[model samples]
Target: MESTTADWVSETRFGKWFLSTETWYREVLSVALREMREIAGPSMPPIRRLLDVGCGQGRSFELLAERFRPREIVAVDIDPLMVRIARDTAGRCAVPVTVMQGSVKKLDLADGSVDAIVCHQLIHHCSQQAQVLSELFRVLAPGGMLLLGESCEEFIDTWSVRWFFRHPPGVQHSADEYVRMVRDAGFGVAPRDIRTSTPWWSLWEFGILRRYGLVRSPLPVTELLLLARKS
Candidate 1:
C-alpha cells in the first residue's frame, strides 16, 4: 500500500507512547495477553516459532517470549523507528527477538513457517485488511493459530461513535464480519469476551478460531476477541 512520510510518523508517535508509558500499554495489552494465554491454555506445547505482526516496539513479543519461551520470535512493523526501538528493547530485555521493517500485508517470511501469529491493534491501520489476512494465512502452518485483537466495528453503529473512530483514523470491523472472514479463510471460531480493568476505555474481546471445524455460540456483545487457525 502507498504510505507517506506523515503516515509513518503518525504510526511512530502512537508506538512511542505505547512503549514509553507503562500504564497505557499495560492497561490494554495486559488484557489481550491474558486472553491469548487463556486460549492457548497452560498445557499447550511450547511455541517454537512465532510471529508478531505490526509488533511496535516488540512489547507484545517480549511478553510472549517470557511466557511461551519460543525459540525464535519475529516482529515486523512498517515504521523504521518502531523497528529500531523494538530491536533495542529486545536487546535490553535479553529476549531473542528479530525485528523487521516491513508491512504485514507483504511479509518476507516463507509459507507455513510459523506456529503462532499474533497481531494487536495493527489491522485498523492497514489499507488492505483482506490482503493482509491472506498473507497471514499463507505464512501460517497448518493448525497454526492466528490471534487478532482490534477495535470493534460495532463501535460505529451510531454517528457519534463513528465520529470518534474517524478522528482516530482506525478501520473498524464488526465482530461478525471478522468471524466470517476468518471462517472463509478456513478457520474455526472460538468465543470469548474482551474485558479490561478499566471500564471506560476498555476495548477487549477474546475469541479463538481454529482451522478445524469447531464452532461455538455467538457472542451478544459489540466488541469481541477473535482467534482463528489455519488448516
Candidate 2:
C-alpha cells in the first residue's frame, strides 16, 4: 500500500471527522461567513457566479447561499464521491448550484468566469499550491474576492494532528509563508487581508485542557484566514 498527497483529499478522509464533524463545520462556517462579509464590505458588487474549491460533500453550499447568495454556485472537489454529494446537496439548495470534480491546480473553467472564489482548508493538500493559487486568481473576475482559510504547519505538526492526518510535508507553510505565497500568486494581500487565529479546537487539541482553569494555555497558530481580491 502506498499514500500520496491526493490521499489527503480522498473519500475515506472526507468520511472521517475532518469533513463530517459537526463542531468542525460550525467553527469553520462561522468564521468563513463573517470574514467573507467583512472582506467584501459595503460597496461590494453582486455575486452572480461563485466557485467553492474543495467543496467536499457540499457542506458549504448552504452557508454560501445564506451569505453570498450567488445566483449560481459551482461546487468542486477532487473526489468523485464528494462531487456526487455536492451535486445532490446543491440540487436541494434554493440557489442554483453546480458541482464538478476537478483539481484547483488545473481547473476546466474559463478564465475570469467566477464572481468570487471560496477556497478554504484546501491549500495544504495541494502538491502545487502556487498552481492552485494561480488558478483561483485566474478564475476570479476583476474586482472579485477570494476567501482563503487554511491551517498552517504549526497546527499540522501538533501531536493530535500528526496522529490523525497525512499530509505532504514539503507543501506545508507557516502563516507568514502562506500569505507570501498568496501575494506572489498576484493577489492583493493587504495587512488587513491577512488574519491568524488559534481556534478553540486548536486551544485544546485533544479537548483535555479546555475545562481546566489551571492552564489557560498554549494557543498554537492553527488557522490563517486571508480574504484577498483580484484587481
Candidate 3:
C-alpha cells in the first residue's frame, strides 16, 4: 500500500550505508536499546507483538528478540531497498517477523494492534512528526509502551550530519520538545520515563576533545530516549 503522506525524507547514500554498518549496530542501535530498556525499568510491558518503525536493514530484530522476547515482530520502513534487505534479516531472527514497506505517518496495521513500538532515530527525517506520533498512538494498544529514541535538534542540526544526511528541513526539535511532542500525542511521558544524553558519537569530533578533558562543560543533549505509555 502507498503511504498517504509524503512528509518523509529518503536517507542519503551515506546514511543508508551507515545503517548497515557494525558501528551502527554496536554503538548506536545497541546503546539506544540498552538505555531505553534501563529507563523502562521493571514495570515495562509484556510485548506480545512489537512494531519496529523504520527498521533499517532489521538490525534491531535480534536485539528486540533478546531483550523483549516478543511472540511476533512487525517491522516497517519507507525505503523499499531497506524493506527488502530487512526481510532477509528478519528471516534470521528467532521471533516471527513481518517486514513491510510503508510510512509511519499512516501505518497499515489495525488500531490498538501492537503491544509495543520501537521508534528509534526516526523522527529527525520526517516532516510530519506529530502525525507520525499520532499514528503510532493509534496503533498501540492501551497500556502499551513506545520506546522512542531520537537524535535531538542539537545533533541533527550540526554541519557534519546535515552534510551527510537528508532530513526534512526545519523539523528538528530539542530533547524537551520531543518529550512534549509525545505527551501531546496522547502518550503518558512521566519525568522519570525520559533520558537525555550527549553520546560520544553525537559529538562533531566524536568526543575526542571531551575524552581528553579539553571540553569540560556539559554539552547540549543530543540524544533523547524515552518510554511513553499509552493510556
**lDDT leader:** 3
The order of the candidates by TM-score, greatest first, is: 3, 2, 1
Query: Candidate 1, residues 1-231: lDDT per residue as tens digits?
Result: 223542332433443564567774676677777787777776766677889998877777667877667788888998777788788877855457788888787899999999998887776666567777889999988888888776565443446544333223444566667667667776666665233121234322223231132534443345456678776
Q: Per-residue lDDT for 101-165 in model 3, tens only?
A: 88889999999999999999998888989999999999999999999999988999999999998
Query: If scored against the real structure, what TM-score would every candidate get?
Result: 0.76, 0.89, 0.95
Q: Over all chains combined, what TM-score does candidate 1 have?
A: 0.76
lDDT on C-alpha atoms for all candidate structures: 0.67, 0.79, 0.90
Q: Best-fitting candidate, measured by TM-score? A: 3
Residue 82 lDDT in candidate 1: 77
Provide the lowest-lDDT 10-residue window in model 3.
1-10
Comparing 2 with 3 on TM-score, the higher-scoring candidate is 3
Instruction: Give residue 205's lDDT in candidate 3 (0 to 100).
Output: 85
